[model samples]
Target: MEGKLRLAKKNLNISLKQKPASFQTSSPELTEMLGMKLAKWIKKHRVGCVVFLGPFGSGKTTMIRGVIKGLTGLNNITSPSFTIVNQYAKGKMNVYHFDFYRIKNATELESFGFSEYIDSGLLLIEWPEVAMEKIPPKSLKVTMEFLGLKRRKITIGFI
Candidate 1:
């Protein structure tokens, strides 16, 4: 088990070096697919941070919600737009989902100790443009763009 785990880690490191990013088909169905893929990937990594960026009305939040629903081990998923941050847990791992669309400044995020949360859990941040300066170095960036009323294009990258 230990050797397998080590080998997996080594392969992941090499893969990250060779191709640190991935893009997938986007739509309500594709969004769900991306979410499931992301969830599975996160399970292997155990923990990481991610940020989602998109213009208003883009389906960034929707894609995440779909992922949470499709992936059972992850805790119940809900939008944190009004609450600022929502936390879900699966076993020992935690996923902190945040929406800063209504937030204007870093100060608003400071009260939440946004830095600490970004470091601690698998952070999924929406409307990250408003708080780009606050994102941790390990955070992966996911950018979504509206392709149609019900479609989106999402690109995932490690930073």
Candidate 2:
């Protein structure tokens, strides 16, 4: 059943309803700008969750910093590596940033009541592979890949 669900998800063209977008960034500044653009889309759509897929130093955090700054106008964005999750408030909306890099399994996520946050606020998860099964099916997925030097290719779509 899970395999079928995965296959069906892969075949679904979410872009048909809402076009997917991609961006290339050669510096942290550009990456953050791209993230800010995505933030606007998320707010317009009232997106509840976003999953970020990328290796370390691929500028995932940098992009998230842009999103937070754009939405909340707070410049103190940082990775939640040690804390696991960080929450920020923007008016009535709350942004929950989660890093699953150190998580070993889904059970670890459940131990901290992860689902509650997903149900309540805008969620941005980094290294989502560690808890793929827990991610909401409707969540947007962003993939970042290193091209060369400081350049990164970011693809945004729904799955």
Candidate number achieving the greatest TM-score relative to the actual structure: 2
- The lDDT, on a scale of 0 to 1, for candidate 1 is 0.66
User: Cα RMSD (Å) per model?
Assistant: 7.5, 9.1
Q: Give lDDT: candidate 1, residue 124.
A: 80
How would you encode candidate 2's per-residue C-alpha lDDT over 1-159 as one tens digit per residue? 432333223322334377766666677877787777777778877778889998999988999998888788888998999999999997987899999898888788888778777678889999888777778777899899999988788888986
Give the Å error, residue 71, model 1: 5.7
Consecutive 10-residue window with the lowest summed lDDT within model 1: 6-15
Error of 1 at 133 (Å): 2.5
lDDT per prediction?
Answer: 0.66, 0.81
Which residues of candidate 2, in runs, are more than 4 Å off? 1-19
Candidate 2 at 104: error in angstroms? 0.3
